[model samples]
Target chain A: MSGTSAPATAHGPHHAGPYNPAKGRLGMWLFICTEVLLFGGLFLLYAVYRYRYAEAFHAASGLLDRLFGTANTIVLITSSLTVVLAIFEFERGKPTRARNYLLFTLLCGLAFLVIKSFEWGAKFEHGLYPNAPHLMSMGFGEILYFGLYFTMTGLHAIHVIVGMSVLFVAWRRIGKGTLMRTRPAFLENGGLFWHLVDVIWIFLFPLFYLIS
Target chain B: MAETAAHAGAYGEGPYFNPETVKPGPAGWLTTTNHKRIGVMYLSLIATFFSVAVILGLLMRIELMYPGQQIMSAKVFNAMFTLHGVIQIFLVVIPGIPTIFGNFSLPTLIGANDMAFPKLNLFTFYLFVAGAALAIGSCFTGGGAPDTGWTFYVPFSLKTAVNVPLATFAVFVLGMSSILTGVNIVSTVHTLRAPGMDFGKMPLSVWGLYSTAWVQILATPIIGITMLLIVVERIFGIGVFDPTKGGDPLLYQHLFWIYSHPAVYIMILPAMGIMSDLFPVFSRKNIFGYKMIAFSSLAIASVGSLVWGHHMYVNGQSDTAGIIFSLLTFLVAVPSAIKVVNWLATMYKGSIRVEAPFLYALSFVWLFTIGGLTGMFLGGLSTDVPLHDTYFVVGHFHYIIFGGTGFGIFAALYYWFPKLTGRMYEKRFAIVAWLTTFVGFNVFYFPYFVMGWQGMPRRYFDFPAKFTELQVVSSIGSYIMVIGIAMIIGNLLRGAKKGEKAPDNPWQGATLDWSLPSPAPLENWDVPPTVTRGPYEFNHSEDDK
Candidate 1:
């Protein structure tokens, strides 16, 4: 691992030899890009379905709590900022401060999940489970629209839970002062994953709560 | 003074092992970014999954022993087939050789100290485990496991009563893990090779993984996306593939195959690379056309992508698409044939040792040749009409996957177990296991070809009395294959604990993996190694007897 470090070059002409963190990050980014494409296919399905059942989707969109959706959006965006700041704090060698911000980010993730569960609870109370034969009484397009809304959002919620766990790990490591400090790769990687979860919500919020 | 000494930390002792530990122990495994450790974890877990699916496969054969459902209900049968397909494809075949062997050894083969991103490598392992948990969790969910097959084709997939969403989500996560590993490997090979190790000097194993890496990076997304869309459709009544919503069902097939087609080569090309490595070492000769074998891997990966359309040929695709896919599929075969020819030529007029790895490799040539030729039979439109959805297709792919890739994996395992474990297996038992596997494999699958020709459809728990005899033969073959697998497990597990100590370069191979101390150092290479010769140069060894 010891070699001529790439001259402390700031974004130097993309070093061709030896390991580069920039290249590693770019590789991770490219990987995330593939994820986007993977998720894009499902979005394509969402778009097609939305177009076909616009009336029903619009009606189902009405059933969602826009206030809670908007609140969760703000919570996620704020948490993303908090996570980015934690990275900056770690970069500045303030491990204790970084730990606090990471903890905050974790709390925000938890809050979002809590809100989502309540929202899901309400839907379950209404017997909105997917493919419920009784859902046909809700209108054909509405039945299909709510089905997708529940599925997409449900998957996204699972992602939120996963993201929270990742952030929690970072938080604990920062608290212990044993986090790899020479490079803030863990924070950065966790940040990347968190942003992906955030980005998924950016798509899901509109599809499920604002499609009309 | 004594109390202070009791609390005093030793140079090596700690409450827990940090990533810095190079020695083999529990701590080294948990947090180590060493590619080899990560690779071992991948291979070990995947082997467990493989064993489970193999049992399921045998059960399937057993169930078909009688005309009607004897061992299980129709529902259980459906779940069995679905579980078998899903588990083997994602949990075993996809990661079997690549993440396990490729991740562990590719860096070593190219003389790199570690992957370009070691942390990412560890992360991929965790992701794989998480995905696996989700998949296993689906089995216990209220509705039962997903039964739409591995492809999870729409309509049925969307309407399935099982926890299909959970399983699909698991696959989606696993695919991401695969993509990240691909990115890590590709970049590592591009930027991490030793100074003298040019792309041409890179071993064919590296080449094979490098080729398959892009398929994982690029092709996996299509399936990832398709699986997600199905989840969306099922939950939201998304009309993308629903006829009621003006969506086209056929498009699902299109996107699914776009990724799944190239996935076939992803499963095989690494095995070919393993064969290429073994061929020259055992023959005590330089590969006859090293460059050809290396480039053929690329040729196979590139052409393999364009041929996904072949899987959809009989599913109402346009004739032009069919023709294009057929021709390209046929074109991909040429490189494979070139590889076989070159491997044969390497063995000609030279010292040949039928060692365990080489025996497996040799069987790969025979089995893969049959698998490859039968693939041609399925690729052509005229011939495919009769074989599509029949046992013939099942037999053909099983040959390629189980016989070819699976055997190739065993070859690599036997070849590298020494380097990984610093121990040698019992030679006679290994050969017996290989022969048993080889013989039992052909017996189990070859008859399916005959039944396939007789218009017997696959995924059936019940069959006509006429097909009963062949079913019996196939079931017997399954038992034989099971014993063969048992022999392998016994040989390897016992050998790891009690086998003879292996020399660093037991096979007198020239690859960088053997350049280090046996079982590898904690850092893989204590000092970065410089490549001095091409990977296949047999006589370049100064210590060769």
Candidate 2:
């Protein structure tokens, strides 16, 4: 995986010749284009519905816990920081340090999700979730408002899980010494995916919890 | 990672790379990372599903033969068409040309031995199978078949009693597969091209795929998220696109067209690439306006992605937006028109080979031109008002997708029959099949333009008595077309198994593929290949730099 191609195993024929990190990097970026557009669709919805029901969206924003929203945002941003640091350690030949950084980043991802669940649970207890009696009473605008809130944030949560899974794989590969300084694509691409997850939340934070 | 010692020793030195010789049976093929074997795998699946979709089309046409239900009830008709649209679009055309031809020929086209990510390529094939299974499963698992069209328009999609969630999830899975394939192709082209073969020297098909990969990566995800949201809406009644809860169905139209329109390009651009390769080889001439044709592919991908709004003109989108979309839609025709002109110019005065592949390519140009020209009428804001959702729309797309892309697939099969299987098909049967298909295709789709101009709506199982005669004619035409399709499939399949051995450079093609030995090896080139000249330097007849 360094300069040479990975061997063909019982897995059948493999791409011969030397391994190229740029190829992996480019492939990951193209994948990020899809993830961005996937989230872009949701953001377009937020823009449309927000334009339609400005007053109701603003009032619904007031109901959400800014403390918890701000806390989760900080947790995600810190996780992005750790991912950056993980790659930095990979660059410095300190695989153990990089591994620890990745573990921390993953833990931050979990913490972000745990805090997200509490926020969602609190809303659920207030009968604020979609199709609940009180949310139905909240009328069309608020129901739609909460519906998008859960949809976008819930999707963001799923992405958080995926990013963690990517980091986990990177962590395992790095410890196996296949994804080190000479072959850092696995770790580097994992960092790229994590950054995407973090950036999507930055937009989601302002749109739902902040702009609201 | 230091496997050069063992890899170089074992690479390309053993088996002939044909299935007959290269580790045979399901064990070797099912887990293959070799691009060639993966291509054959895709071909088998595509052929099977194509037959299923063709049958659905025939049945629907038969049902619409008379005024009232001829063979199926209105409900069954709805389900059939829905499945027909879903299967043909996702399982066939969208992935059709790219995965099969791209997998089989791209590395050779670019002079690389394997894709940049081989394991990813095999994983992508499995992803396709998984998505396809779930999509077909949606038809019979819970409730009844999915009645909402492939678009899965909102409100109805959410409220439908059928298994909408499972169906939409299948599309999500499919979209993921498409996105990964796109990513792999882009990376392969960027990093794996033979040394010295820059973008300018690369085959135009590589250009088409490079552009298509970008479209697949960027546009497919909108539909992926949209489909996922459909499932979300179904399970939670989120009312995101449900009108009763203040959600706008128009938003659904916007989101759907955002991907579906570009998807049409995903279906055709590669076919156009095939046309690019075909015109030169058959003419034995340098491809005219090579740079223009190459840039136009990029032009098509970029300009084509923005024209999705053209589909939403009558769906309550603002007139300013509609007019803007209409203008952009018109712009897309320019690049398409340029490519067509260049192809004709490529064949203008050359010594032309009147072969079956050439016949299919000729039909593609003629039919695709009509499809594009008719698209202009529908692109105009005023003209679209009448044609929207009419049989006109249906006919226009069928011309592009089936006539254009489908024929391109046939041409590729005929043209590469020798390279792929080391055999030449019975040429007479191929031409007969092509003639039958050409005649049958026009007969089947052309009447829809007339009926649609006369104001016949689409997706309706029963038509008025006034429309009965043309409907019957269309049904008969489809029967002829299906026979031709079957013959085309049968001839090539029979040839692959038992035809005469084909000579290298069977078409005397000037491309790198012709330089490859018959039944091109499992990993493509025996050693690393480096291309020096332009792809269509037929006079030189060599890509060796």
Q: Ignoring the other chain, what TM-score does chain B have in each prediction?
A: 0.95, 0.96
Best by TM-score: 2
Chain A TM per prediction: 0.86, 0.90
lDDT of 2 by residue, B273-326 (tens): 988999998898889999999999999999998899998888888999998999
lDDT of 1 at B175: 88
Interface RMSD of each: 8.4, 6.1
Deviation of model 2 at B337, angstroms: 0.9
Candidate 1 per-residue lDDT, tens place, B43-118, comes to 8899899999999998888899869877888788888998999899989988788898877788778766567777
CAPRI classification of candidate 1: incorrect
Tens digits of per-residue lDDT, candidate 2, A1-212, equal 12122222121244444766777887887888888899999889888998999989988888999999899889999999999999998898898999999999989999998999899999999999888988888767798899999999999898899889989999998888777598788788889999999999898887877763
Highest-scoring model, lDDT: 2
Model 2 residue pairs with clashes: none
> Candidate 1: DockQ?
0.18
What TM-score, over all chains together, does every model reach? Answer: 0.79, 0.95
